[model samples]
Target: MLDHEVNRFNGIEIEAAHAPEDPECFAGELAAALAAWEEAGRELVWLRVPIERAALIPVATAAGFRFHHSQEDYVMLVRRLRPDALVPHYATHYIGAGGVVLNSRGELLVVSERHRRSARPYYKLPGGALHPGEHLVDAVIREVREETGVHARFEALVCFRHWHGYRYGKSDIYFICRLTALSDEIIRDEREIEECLWMP
Candidate 1:
């Protein structure tokens, strides 16, 4: 059998590095592996192929492997050995953060977005989506600076909301953080924000 990892469930994850360089060899090995896994009661199978191994994609597809998701460096594929087998979906939530910044003068910092579904100007907190591996405190501070060019530091996590069926049918978790402004500059991201100001 090809090199693999067994999880808690009746599933096996094939190692990409163990995959054969030749398509014919891979096909033969994969077919044999599938048969052995079926007899071994394996339900789900996961295979990740790096971009450099593009030639193996067609071979895998011919063996019933379907695309699960993709990344910059690799593509993941999955196959269910049994008819009623279950494979969970990929990451389902997008993370976001908003900053509630207050200055020493007791003024709140806010902004109006450049593009929106509504025609009328609607002012809101200055913040946006968090990057991968970004901390809540850092994300809130970064978002505030990126949106309004105001330097700020995290004070506390004021609130958060989780909603289903957001953009692209995925859920979203938005963190609202209270922050103290370090700078009062009103420079805004002209591409993203129409206006930005400090209101008392």
Candidate 2:
């Protein structure tokens, strides 16, 4: 058993245990630790385990803990945390940010910028350059509002594509996918945006 204290917001003591040999012994120890933390007014209990030991999930669930899907090295199972948890700043660089917005009828929203002057004039997702110290979600929301003249709420990061020596030097293009049901009352401000259409 490992004992530690975390004093980020509310000071709470922590005790963690791991089982490299016997799974049955570790399960009992983990359950005891969780109960002790709860008695001490702790709100969260974290457990890290290998993906191969997925059987621990059932034990954690039985102990009132939930498993969160992650794309990291180890699987993270946690007990109750705060409801209003602040999102951490994880992205280091923001080369470019954009997302696909789908309406209620599963139609994709595309935009035509007034600044683009080309022969074909093809359309693209509604997003632009990311400002310094700006999060991807905030940058995308500002870009959609500026280019499409409509308010949007960011959903999640879908996929990311990296492009080198394109137009703006070496950059990482993130295709953030968001689901939004557009209302019929769209008030278009035609200064930066040429047109906004919902395409099926």
lDDT scores in order: 0.91, 0.64
lDDT of 1 by residue, 1-200 (tens): 68899989979998676789888999999999999999989998899999899889898899999999898989999999997998898999999999889999999998999987799999999888889998888999988998899999888998899999988899999999999999987788999999999988
**Which ranges in model 1 have alpha carbons more than 4 Å from their true place?**
none
Candidate 2 has a TM-score of 0.47
Give the Å shift of residue 158 in candidate 1: 2.0
User: Clash pairs of candidate 1?
Assistant: none
Candidate 2 regions exceeding 4 Å error are 1-94, 182-184
Q: Which pairs in model 2 have colliding backbones? A: none
Model 2 lDDT at residue 194: 73
lDDT of candidate 1 vs native? 0.91
